[model samples]
Target: MKPGFWIAPEGAEEPVNIFPIGEEALDASHKGLTASGALAKLASLDSEALARSCPRAVELLSTIAAAIGAQTAGAPTQLFRLEGLNDLERRLIDDVLGEGEVAGVVALPDGTLAQIQESVLAGIWRVRLEADERHDYVEIGAVPEIVSRAAADLTASDIAIGPVPEGTMNALPVLAEIRERALSWRPGQRSQTINFTLLPMSPADMGFLQQTLGNGPIQLMSRGYGTCRVLATGIRHVWSVQFFNAMDTIILDTLEVGGVPVVALAAAEDFEDSAERLTQIIEAYFT
Candidate 1:
């Protein structure tokens, strides 16, 4: 809703590349389905037969179409439960909701893991909670509840002010600033960022800050005009938001204190395009 959320972040205008430029990275960075890619992937499969068999899956897609039309991103998610679906029904849901740009995982306190990914349609997310049991659902919103909820669950109310270790210099004030902002930040408050890349940080100071605000389980990557990785840290409401160039160099590294980084979430304006594309796919095949 603010000015800087949707605009491309400050960086090179090249497309985002998640993996490094190596043989192993190439193997790991396999591309997901595109519009044409989806067609190729399903060329042999009978669309009408699958759709006819999975009525509930079709209904789920229709529901997503309607909810996305509302354009209420950043609000409470509109969830469509996927439990009790037979194997065929599951295939129908999985095939149509191809992967989008953003991907994330949040480990819950109960030790269960919530895998979150945006669908090919923006503002539509696929959340799977897995561990002892598996639960799948489609959450229509800007970002999944698991992500925002995990941020709220951070223990940042009062960080443990430990003694400064050997070689520690200049990290005290940084931590203090972080702690003060974290304590005062509310859900709707404007986000505050301390750009470490712009500031001066020595080896020892950087090490101390990293260890103090360790990385948390929730990590989100937005593959837009360059990669923007949003990682929640051990400190409450504090996050490490790093922007990378096409060559995978860390162009900007900052610690944001407040809510999850807006770059990782789809903006309200993305809803119409997503709805139209999904509705087209449904009418073409799922109908």
Candidate 2:
């Protein structure tokens, strides 16, 4: 007769604990004279006796594998027991196991069986598998570092500064400059008219401008660029303004109306201390 084991899905009401194999089952499985019977003989022995019988242990493992295969129809399974191997042995088992959820037995450390089960349910022992050609097996370990690096890179890359430019200009001149730039960037296309607004400069205004320029919608204004309204206040508010760029792409589009580009370079004042950090931030987005 083929040897076999049983499995039960975890249940909410069921007591959370590791159950060990009973002596009777062990004895029955290990009891004959042939090589297959070695497991039974080993079961009759105490841990010390079994420890001395390496050949018997090996045979027993084979028998258990056969029994599990015959019983489980090749499905993954794990055997849980309350007193078996030490921590090193458990780590070794995890290291050697194949990919795809191989089923096996776990002999929990005596008094901590219940706690261990709870930990397992909480995913404390989860391991990832890596491809290996030698043994046609996968080595299990912690999550790879590349995944985390990729996520961080993507987040840093997505950050952007503006649809709003640094300086402010009049509605008409800014719009005209933007259109001119756009035409220069992509010739033969007619410039589109963009609406502009002028508002008073205040802390709240600064905050709103920061938000709108930092992360806002302006893609509707131009195909490759976004549009933003600038608030020009104070003395510089009266002059006509023009934006200079390499490709003539109208990055900033708004006419120089009745305001000045609020020049508060206070944030960028500590050049030595902040230059490198700002450079890194800017480079992260562009590169």
Candidate 3:
């Protein structure tokens, strides 16, 4: 992964709080059985147990099928919960689907631990919640709803300026513009991302900008070529997004004033293709 402003703290030796799903997490676990072994076990299940397992698998498979078949083409974002399935069954399902590029385990303010994993099928995500009863869901979209929903909610009243150091002239204008854009945003509106990188600003200007915006609670990391770090600045709707190269050098630096960045968003076509891909997966097991 490339390293830059996105992957690490600027001018700092160590990364702040980046939770990257490592290779170990992405590697399929064949502790006692392989994916095919699980499939064979599933196929040999007796009628009553199959009634329990197959229904859940088929329900998920059906959603994947419909998602591919155009039946859900125009449907609103869908979240399907797999009720009454044990962890083993769920693990089997995951093994069948395989793992995708990114996965994350986030702890929300309300103390809910939400784990989100992109399926091998791109836009399709497997979201799991660790509560009294496990809640497992399959979601297809740009990013999971939990991420956007968990972002810090900011309002005008929440904006307060602190004393700035001497010679910090350029930051005020940029800060004001960001404040205005952030305050005007409404939920469900199209994402409005402002690229601060295009502007010619000095290090002092950038420093002042970060100091003024403050820091928010949420910190997210996604990996592709290198890594991209998305930080929720203390102010509402304002996010510090940075992309890094494999060398850990910051390649692109910008502030996004919306839900999430497009780079982190899965293109709609991904979900469309995921449906057909999932169908083939299910067929392979049955065959």
Candidate 4:
């Protein structure tokens, strides 16, 4: 209450208003009780499947838990190959690790295809590599490593800026700016992103830049809440990054000249935490 305001009688003030603004307690106990009851109901629903899981499935779960523990302790990610898993075992694994929202499908230069899918349990990933042969793997991390590794090998090459066509006044300046930025770039430097979408450029200016920059082979597509595409430009390190809405409409378009776009890479700390959570999930299932 304000110093000059009338004092309310004992227990007259609303319990919520009694606490000053921004000072309310979280009151997690109420939520915790609700969550515990809900989880018990869910456990009852999955009791049959939990009991029916095969010994192989249990062994695989334990192995995954141990791998997560190692990863949490700053070890590299562990891959549990699923090649030998029978159909029933696969089903059991699916029952325990449901799908999550974040996933990526990338095409490697060798024509091999790889898919990384997160599980409902954060940090646990299902990674599948397909070429002439198929290999299935389960990985525990914040995000899959291949997504970043695939882009790492691409090197920036020199670009020969062509003469700016007539009627494109600012195109030459833009090109010069980009070339200067690219030449000065070094590893581990702060990222510099240029948003051509925001610039006042004519169609001819865009055409000149696109033709001069050219295109590179490496392309990455990652999906979560929406979609993001990173394509290498002929000028090494320079990439065309585009974000799209659920309807596939372009929302943001820009050029990133860096090792890789920050959004495309997962933080190490995130992986560490994911590993810990994954370990807990496995242990809880057993208990």
- Number of the top-ranking candidate, with lDDT as the measure: 1
lDDT (Cα, 0-100) at 171 in candidate 2: 27
Q: Is candidate 3 or candidate 4 better by lDDT?
A: 3
Q: What is the TM-score of each candidate against the true structure?
A: 0.84, 0.16, 0.73, 0.65
- Per-residue lDDT for 159-261 in model 1, tens only? 7767777876678898899989988988788899998776766666766777677657686777767877787888778888888788766788788988888
lDDT: the better of candidates 2 and 4: 4
In candidate 3, how many Å is residue 15 off? 1.9
How many Å off is the CA of 213 in candidate 4?
3.6
Clashes of 4: 2
Q: Which ten residues in a row have the lowest lDDT in candidate 1?
A: 1-10
lDDT tens digits, residue span 164-234, model 4: 78867567887777888888888678778887657777766666777788655444445555876666666
Model 2 misplaced stretches (Cα beyond 4 Å): 1-60, 72-82, 101-287
Candidate 2 Cα deviation (angstroms), residue 20: 30
Clash count per candidate? 1, 26, 18, 2
Q: Return the lDDT, model 2, position 32.
A: 20
Candidate 1 wrongly placed segments (more than 4 Å) = 1-31, 42-44, 132-134
| Per-residue C-alpha lDDT of model 2 across residues 97-215, encoded as one tens digit per residue | 11111111222123211100001111111222223112111111111122112212222212122454444433234434433443243212332333222322333333333332222
